[model samples]
Target: MEIRPMRSWIHHRRGEVLRQGGVGRSAMPGVYEDMLTRHGFEGRDAYLYRRHESTAWKRAEGAGIHLDLDGRLLEPTDLTDAGGNPLRLFYNPDGAVSVSRRSANMTYSARNADGDELYFVHKGTGTFYTEFGPIPYEPGDYVLLPKGVTYRIRPTGPDNYFMIIETTEELGFADIGPHGRRAPFDPGLLYVPSPELDDLGDGRNQDGEWPVRVKYQGGFTTAYYDFDPIDAIGWSGDLFPFKLNIRDFRPITSDRIHIMPSGHAVFATSTVVVGNYLPRPLESAPDAEPFPPIHRNMDYDEFLFTHAGTALGVPMPPASFALTPRGLHHGLPAKVEEELRKGIKPGTVADFEFIFVDWAHSLVATPEALAQKRAGDQLREGVAAQ
Candidate 1:
């Protein structure tokens, strides 16, 4: 019988900061005990949770669950040289996700119309020949190729391994702010391939046999060329391939507080964000917590690929990959905390080099990545007891 503007129904008792008109916005009648803020609340995006506190260690139920990257993750990539094809790990229908391992040199050039590609060189050296030019890539180099760019990998040695991430969207560097831009080397230092247009002339493919496979519409169509595919007398455009070394990425740290994971982000798009945790000094404050805060991030599924160094004393070797789904609580173990308490030299580099990918949606874990997943019962039981 009453016509009034509908107000949020938040349950709150006196003395609660979340009470009606108290602190945060109130749409319901109860207090939201858990609040996650981005940009230290300056971003103005606050996620409120009811009866779900990420710090509730008692609810962090896990039993030593682990995804072993070296054994299980790499097992699915056992691509035989039957036809000299690369092994694919996973592919999504939306073309938003694709991971593959390439060892043998590629024979044909490829052009993807769906998205860009990022290749992490794990072993060997090679020259990535693209329409723009030739990029000499070595181990630890992250080479990025934009969509519609015809390119092929030419390995110089017999041993070569590559981790490739193909995304449906264009990839660009994160805002990173003035601080991150200043800490790392100048952005201009990134290596861009100079135009090396090599025309094979009319004799290279008189039979019109060389095919440049174009990927689109869920499949591929071959485009035959009378000459070599890398025939670009000269090219000019903002879109081109580039390479950056992991050693060139300098991490940003806080002297008095622990920096958030996003602080290390190097590149990102609407659906995915990529970060690099390079060797850096740990939190220098005597009482500061060196590890990330315990919380359940419901926004993105996190994937950590260990490229070098042990991650937070976890003994993560190179090529190790791990995925922590959304709503899961992951943090440093007690033993690690104890070790941190023992006192680390102020400038001691924690040697935690890894690539962190935060996907907006749940990442589809391949069966091979799930093969050797360790039980999380211990973590569950420990959290319950707490």
Candidate 2:
């Protein structure tokens, strides 16, 4: 890890106390609060009190990309052909995010030689037939398949949607800190399959080649076998594929302050951090914002898939998702900010829910995503409606 410089200083303001006489407070009357933070809101921060919206801009022409995509419209190749795989959405050296709309059972098994894979079930029920065993999946579940582990997914239903984050690094559970794992989720809630050999059969076409496709460095290598290769009847190991549903997550909340996103991290690797933006009690402090702080995260890029609910006045359709590149100021949509500007009562609830993944480095979107990109701003969702 690169050493970040540390220094000692006192925070002094140049402007008058618009209202709360403090830093990082959200919209109050005509004033706006914008924050610049390091370490994903866990480190040093500078809150800017402005007379205007922090997310406002005259125009963003090039690299100032803030993307909002409608995943409900994406047509992944896997939806039609069994030989097809997830359609690449965004990628960088560390990882890639893809979407799969597969409606059929796989004709062959596959393995990722590059890294571990995470499949966030946006919709549908299915079973992951892996070498370890079979793990059934449903909407709102996160299925993790370790690198080099052979697996294939078979949908139990016809309509299915999945948001997948496949990375080139090892994946593990996030530390629950002093609260222990029971706080966010109980490890016991994880559905880990043991190696069991039952109903295991040859490929759909038993008389044909049963191919084991291995994906490495964005290329596939097929090894055909006359007989099925998933022959493990018993195995003993801590390493295996598992599933965790979002409904079981208990996100920490505070009525006094808006907790940072990192506080919601359920999974992390050296290169990525995955979190659930579940509904929780909003801040009730008389002087604080009820929503997340308006922030320009200096380090990581954020990717969010809205499973349900309207967020920041943005009515989320099925499979709604957004991307806020690192350094881009983001938070509530402008329309919601305006509502906050008016005033909010005590004990408000944050009803919005989504699954967010943060990459330590930047992500490059695929051509498919670029073709239908929507120009977004903090207010665009609301502004466009007008």
Candidate 3:
């Protein structure tokens, strides 16, 4: 049997650094500041100041930061598939992120037998007609649906956008921790719809022999219903779909240092945890760097949807998405890094809002997802400047 070495959490530092923590401290000249940490900035860590620094390494796999494929450019199945489904973009064993461009009501009620589904309303005002009740959703609202629940979205506006996340396990609100249950967003603020008692809808989904689309094990099975599926007179249970809007989210901030991304965790399944990166103040200490340090997410893959606003004045277009694998260094765009190196301006606030998933499994961007890169570039090739 092989034996493992004992590990210690003691602090050890050498070469050009006179101290341990980099907070309010600057490294010596000609030193490349890079940190290697375990458990996403937690656990034992090391700050290495190397003599050489370069990103000129060549060739293959997750090559560049892809911010070109706008979410609106891709065509979802709701526009093409006869049954009306979203377009699968990035997926893994644990979860998947798909984009939906829906402007009309779904003809068939859909049920996911595979996993719990959640939709981030990027752009739309719609009512999610579920078996329980009708939950009206707006932009920045997250519509949470339990697995095997019957539901269909009916948009009341044009250019409706949705980014769907489906996971194998049920997702619950992340722990409130030291702040308690009411700090981030009170459980009371969650709008759990009551079943429509008097009237579900006037002649809606009344098409003869209405179909219920059931997605199971990568294939779909349709079950025909003799009447409308939203015929629930009453519902009494703890397990039901609900909505949590971004407006209710209270962020954790610190002017001393740029807090870790985990501080913004909102929802989590057994295998994945979702983080909401909302607009907030940046670090303000005189000697402290105001941006995330150059580090690798060693344990989980990072996938993000840039929803809106300027990311610290860095021009990441709204609705653009990007994926940084587990081992690759996180991208610090040139313009943003320059401001970081100089330390952020005092009392500066970043208005950028994004939805990111720190999934435990390595993700694979689907072929149709990859094809969007080519299609996007071609579409933008001859467009006139605004």
Candidate 4:
């Protein structure tokens, strides 16, 4: 299947709203208070109000909001009414749902879909159910669902948060040459619940039908389907739900020198590549120093979401993201490299996991994203000057 750069449809609309001076009425009763008094929203401020609103809005529109499926610019109408909901966003036209987990106590249903889905769990811990069984997932876990699978999420220990990328396209691993189907990364690593776990109280199947609710126009729309979302039955095929634990991705390395950035690839789609900082031995050869210059590869576009630890000597205060588009000369800044040369361990199992969703098709940054880029540069300068 052809891979395309995915964009967040919500961010584009939110940028429009911000450009248009916010949505709804700022003075109108806040969605929090209104939902609490009217819709029985009793969650904490963080859940009902704080961060949740923006998270929900972004998810509804799309995370990594790009243009559109046809590569056209996304407009406001492209976004569904994700307002008032605590944890989900529904897409227009296709009815695909993007669920964002903002709190640890959040529990929601994973209903059946007419199309396939890709879920990236960014934070928190939880138990996810498929028609087969329940699989426990933690932060940085990615899950893929085939079309028509029914599932639900239960945040067992703590409130967890994650982002789901729903699409009609079937997502699979990039084809490896000669190896054919059995690639280095086993498809089974994606984790389906065992039969023992499958017996965990009959999952979310309600009499062969699953209850799904959608938001359309300005109200709630509920629909019941006649088949269980997970009715894949006994079909063994390449296209199926899989999960890859980001932590389990073993990075290839060189014993005497740092490998090239492409060596850091954990996964790649047709147009996108996910890279990690895997552990490598320090290159201390004659005339070779411990620090390696940031090598720029122009073959693909790269966006790094800093999942953990400091990377390239840049002090990432956790959960912060950095983007290095194709042709952008990004590497360890000079001073940080100096520190590494002074006997710092050259590698650690890349504590940092970032998604590099490149597109075989070229992409253009939205005007709003461009403005954010300018602001980011200004902030970087301010920090340096400080």
TM-score of 2: 0.89
What ranking emerges by TM-score with the best candidate at the front? 2, 3, 1, 4
Model 2, 24: alpha-carbon shift in Å?
Answer: 8.5
Residue 70 in model 2: lDDT: 73
Mark the regions of model 1 whose C-alpha exceeds 4 Å error after superposition.
1-68, 71-100, 197-208, 312-314, 371-386
TM-score list, all predictions: 0.76, 0.89, 0.87, 0.55
Q: Evaluated with TM-score, which candidate comes out highest?
A: 2
What lDDT score goes with residue 278 in model 3?
86
lDDT of 2 by residue, 93-185 (tens): 988899999888887888999888999998899888888888999988999999988888889887999998887878888764677648888
Q: Please estimate how well model 4 matches the true structure, expressed as its whole-model Cα lDDT.
A: 0.40
lDDT of 3 by residue, 1-386 (tens): 01112345677666566354546435455555556665554446677666654222343354433223566578887865435689899887777889988767777888999898999998989788888988999999999999988987878865788899998888887662578768777889999988874443422344555788899887899888777877897889799999999989988887776677767888887568787888787777766666654566676667778778765565656776666666644445334465545545777777878888877787888877776553333111211000
Q: Ten-residue segment with the worst summed lDDT in candidate 2?
A: 377-386
| Model 2 root mean square deviation, Cα atoms | 3.4
lDDT of 2 at 139: 89
lDDT of 1 by residue, 160-219 (tens): 667777778788877655684556556776898876765433212225466677777647
TM-score of candidate 4 against the unseen true structure: 0.55
